[model samples]
Target: MMERRAYPLRISAVVLDAMQRWSEDELRSLNAQIEFVLRDALRRSGRLRPPPADPMDDTDGD
Candidate 1:
């Protein structure tokens, strides 16, 4: 079970546009890319825990 939570988030149109462009360039879904980037930043800034490794990082135990 996951805990429910919410936080106020605000972003300017210019920032949103830049995020979209970056997501496209990275070949990731916009939501996924945003989550990845934000999570990484938060972890680095001590605002959140480091994100767990993506399943894609697993290679059949090899």
Candidate 2:
């Protein structure tokens, strides 16, 4: 499992409320939703590389 680090964030109330609503709609916790959004943005901007596929997760016939 990937390890997580705690970091304090100071976000505007308006944005926080919007993100909370979005998280509820997606059935995800606020922290997960925020990380998902950040990861997506980083990948889209070519600032983050996709994690290597886990060999143990392979299910296709080989």
**lDDT winner among the candidates?**
2
- Top model by TM-score, which number? 2
Clashing pairs in 1: none
- Candidate 2, residues 1-62, lDDT tens digits: the string is 87789999999999999999999999999999999999999999999977889989967976
State the number of backbone clashes in model 2: 0
The segments of candidate 2 whose C-alpha lies over 4 angstroms from its true place after superposition are 53-62
Please write out the lDDT profile of model 1 over residues 1-62, one tens digit for every residue. 34647666688999989988999999998776878997888888999964577777877788
TM-score of model number 2: 0.81
Q: lDDT for every model?
A: 0.82, 0.95
Give the C-alpha miss distance for residue 27 in model 1, angstroms.
Answer: 0.4
